[model samples]
Target: MPAQQKKIIFCIAGVLSFACALGTAAAIGTQLWVKGTILCKTGALLVNATGQELEKFIGKIQYGLLYGERVRQCGLGGRPFQFSFFPDLLKIIPASIHVSVILFCTVLIIFALVGAGFFMFNAFGSPYETLHGPVGLYLWNFIACSCGCLIMILFSSEVKIHHLSEKIANFKEGSFIFKTHSEQFANSFWIILVCSLVQFLNTLLIRFAGFEFPFSKSKDSGTVTGAADLMY
Candidate 1:
């Protein structure tokens, strides 16, 4: 490819990777990861409560990796809580897996930024060695792609297969109770998936920039002989 075309491809890839990184970071920090309703199961079965009374027992739950909001209709109104994977809900959910999801998300963002930097550097600045060259582009992008995919897969498993929302809704301590009526992965979760796809697409952009895939051997033609060697 021409030098101009290569520069254009790198610029496009850099922009895409940067956007993906920003979206993933926003998704991680927002409380819109999961949205659902929690029903006060205890209140629902109150002996003297009527249908209208039961209607007052439902509340909303919205949570993210670091914090969450819970609204209780029984009397508590809305409350926010911050929690970690180790000691809070680890018993109900796989702490190791959940923590891994967050870890990989962090890795994805870091690698994405690094990849974007390399892409821009190669596009405008002269690059010759491993870190500043095409090899670095492939390395960073590949790592970012892997991290993004892992984040989506691990988080999806926690939400869909493991019933994370239900577990949180039903969690209780002493006389306090939390019950879930319905749960779902929200916009932030979907946005992470989109970011993962975008990272994957960046790998294709890297390939299109005339850099050969790592570990593949290129075909070599026969070596040319000098006139003196031929005469000898």
Candidate 2:
């Protein structure tokens, strides 16, 4: 292909890939934010549990609620009553959605990065040979799969939390809840914000880099129709 045509293709690919990367970064950041909020509230409650019997009971209840469970058994039999703690699926679903978003964003970012790398090489590489724009597409796909796996793990984690909470809440009825994860409470918002910034930077990089065929190489067909030459 002509130099002009190659350059045009490069430009288009670069723009699209960069956009994908930025989008992914933003997604991860958002996930961190949502998780962080929940963590903060949980952690604060855990830290400030100081009081007499009543205060202790309140603390337990608070923790229990966070994981969507109520206390069922405490002090060994106290008449052995049963209690149930179930999270409103409505709330859990939203949490899961937030997680999904993060994964989606990561996938996009990987795609962009991979594409950029491939294209960058292509534009500078050789001439007369065709190079698939970006194999980075696979990178995103892999990341997405990993995200899905994480989501499944998270689902189990949430279930465990619910069961544990229920057991605790029943022990004394609204007396224990789980503390939020530390990273979520302390670093999520900042992490996500930074991610967004990274995305913006990626965008700028793609725009400025301007796409070009990285692998444009001159044809040496005339040298020989030999198998060795073809392989090379």
Candidate 3:
């Protein structure tokens, strides 16, 4: 690629990295990770509710990493309640797994910002060919992508294997028991998936700018050294 074309590619990658950072930050703050409905098992069983009547015993629940809002339906009416994960939910949910997901999110954001800065540096400023150049770009993007994948995996396990939503619904409720009727990952969760893909796409863009994928050069060099040895 021409120097001017490389510069354009670098600039585009930088912009993408920055956008991923902003999107991740926004996702962490918003209460839109999981969306589901909780069935009031106690109430439904008591009333022996069937079909259409069961709707009265079902409530809606949604949450993010930090805090969330849920509408409790126990056959009487929907009762709105707000909650936080810091201290309130520590006793109920899988605190370790939840905390791990959050830690990875933080890691993803930090790496994304660093990657953006480095991309800009490589584009405009003269950088060291080893650390601050192509190698650095590959390293940052790979780490960010890994972090994003870990975040999603950990969170999914916490929700599915540990029964996160049902536990949250049952917390502090002695008389009424709740069960997760239906659940789906919401917009915020999908955003992280998209951000991870963007990081991957940046790697291809780097290749489009004429940079080799990291480590391939070393293997190629070794092959040439073995060929020379055979001749001797």
RMSD of each: 5.8, 13.1, 4.5
Regions of candidate 2 where Cα sits further than 4 Å from its true position: 27-91, 94-98, 127-232
Error of 3 at 185 (Å): 0.3
Full-model lDDT, candidate 1: 0.76
**Residue 138 in candidate 3, Cα distance off native in Å:** 0.3
In angstroms, how far off is 219's CA in candidate 3?
5.9
Instruction: Report lDDT (CA) for all predictions.
Output: 0.76, 0.38, 0.92
Top-TM-score structure, candidate number? 3
Window of ten residues with lowest summed lDDT in model 1:
223-232
What's the count of clashing pairs in each model shown? 0, 36, 0
Q: What tens-digit string does per-residue lDDT give for candidate 2 at 1-232?
A: 5656656555565565565556445434332222211111232354553333222322222221112222221222222223222343333333554355445445546655766555545556542322242223233323433443453344335534544233333233243343422212223334333444443443344344443222333565356655433231
Residue 201 displacement (Å), model 3:
0.4
Candidates, ranked, lDDT: 3, 1, 2
Candidate 1: misplaced stretches above 4 Å?
Answer: 47-54, 74-93, 173-178, 216-232
Encode model 1's per-residue lDDT on 28-126: one tens digit a residue: 888788888877766656544566766677778888876676766654454544454447777878787888988998998898898899889989998
